[model samples]
Target: MTRIFIQDKATFKTTARTYDDAGFLHVPGRVSKTGTQQYLRRELGLDGDPNARVTVYRPPEEVFAADSLASFDGADVTVMHPGELVNAKNYRKTSVGLIRGPGQQDGDFVKADLVVKDADAIAAIEKRGFVELSAGYTAEYEHSPGTTDDGTEYEYVQRGIRINHAALLPAGAARAGRQARLYDHQPKGSTMSKITLDSGRSVEVQDEATAALVQDHIDRLQKQVTDAQAELDKRQATIDGQAEQITKLQAATADDQITARLKAVTDARARAEKIAPGVTFDSIDPVEIQRQALAKARPSTDWAAKSEAYVQAAFDMAFDQVETTDAHADQKRKLAEDGAKVVTDKAKMPAYDSYTARFTQPQAKE
Candidate 1:
């Protein structure tokens, strides 16, 4: 048994168009009939030869099978076959109405009720006389070449018929029309129209009004996604900029620390050189330099047990004492170079004698 997708057509000549309070048009009709000879073409990848034409028998047992007829209930009703299987993916886009009743055997036909919900589809049916329904369904084909009771000969017999959708065909549309096959095999832009957006993007749909509605929804959703992405990109840029600034600040802080450390080391070397004026103290540790200065000031003192702060204080005191003593010695040398200038004038002599008398004790007259 091979699964084949099939479509069959039947007409209804009813002028009794009625609507419920909800403004939906209800039309009672027979979607499929039993004991009909449908001309079918085997699509590619089926059991028989590809594209082979054959007459298929639709017996009442398979047509009015409990499960098969119930499959028509709640199925989609399209304005025309979108030339593809009506499924969950494309159902919203293709469906204009719905088959509302679980179909039952009405004599030799499967009778059901369908509701036309779309205004455009209702207008097409009421005004344009498109009152024909073609049932699009799938069935297993059993290769049994036999003649019917009415002498209708067929090569393939349909079994396990399951209805997927019932399409309202246009006036003069036949069961063997090219729209019975999948939409991919149809010619470009023949059964459907294209909707072009502002971004130069296009979408193909079965009709203009439905395609416009679908395109409107797509545009709104696409804009929302695009806006969200843009906001995320903007926030990311700000974060990147802040990170770069932080890195630069950290680098500058490191450079400043290095400069301050080098200045401290240079100042320490200069102070050590002043403490012992001829000592080479380059690359020497600051603590070791302080110890050497303290040792030179007090030659007999041990500095090994002293803390760094104590050693530094001792070295500063020693340097201050040496500087003071050197200043006094220089003053005495200047006085010796200018020695023994006697004053002859009476007023100057008296003042000089008075100044010298403070440093001399009274001598006994000899």
Candidate 2:
């Protein structure tokens, strides 16, 4: 991307457009001669091309990619150059690893270089993508109508710029690493008005089928969790029925198989009692005690008291069961969210209110 910068100076502030690619400074309004030298050195900080001949104050001729370049040969375009300042050129040279190379010295330079390479200037040139021409004078002879004046002579050569960068053209026209077709003519000014380059565009393609696949996996997992919970509920009901008959058995009245069945219920109850943080499970309610007593009551006159205790036990068991299911449901909900089954479609996913409304929400999306 070409960045536009506005610079101001004393003796009349003017807008000079500079581009990164072409190492040129486009200054409008007769650049004040008094400050022009300092302006080129300080403001534009242009050094002549390594093989260029022009100084910073060297009058810049408006040349295009097709123009010949002869006078500017060996010209090092520099904002500043070493040893050129017979007086003062104090640009801090970061001497961190100066001589770390095969043909270099220690405490040398990085941001600054001993000899600025044409490759470096070309780097900036490629960024702006300009065609270069040599700047030499060529003489053209013409007969004077009333006076004896011969045509002026000039020397020039064809200049080729190493392309730094160019904007891409849409519709598979222009691309990088491939030779770009050139336009026939050179631009008039240093900067042209809305002239576009030929280069490619990039885009991301997503298929409708991909989104559908994610939704399918979400539905399958939710169904598995739902089926598991329903089956668990059915098993608990069966255990409740068997526990009733076990309460009446005394000593060896029932077989060992019945005893095993009763133990299963106790074990399940213990598993459900695992307390969740922040939730109190120590308190036992009357309802749960009555339910347990009723399920374990013997065939005797104390059935009422036994039923009361059973109800209290039932409440505690119910609390634990409820907690477990809630945890499992939360886990499933989070899983669903990960799989795109979020809760409160309007709040989580406004796009899926209708379809996901029937399914549960995942915890993660929340």
Each prediction's whole-model lDDT (CA): 0.71, 0.30
Query: Per-residue CA lDDT of candidate 1, range 221-339, in tens?
Result: 67557868999999999999999999987885797876876777676667766776766553556777777766664668898688989988887787788778889999998776555
Give the residue spans of candidate 1 off by over 4 A.
43-52, 174-366
**Which candidate gets the maximum lDDT versus the true structure?**
1
TM-score of 1: 0.45
* Model 2 TM-score, 2 decimals: 0.14
- Per-residue lDDT tens digits of candidate 2, residues 27-78? 1111111101111222222345444321121112212221312222222222
Best by TM-score: 1
What lDDT is obtained when candidate 2 is compared to the true structure? 0.30
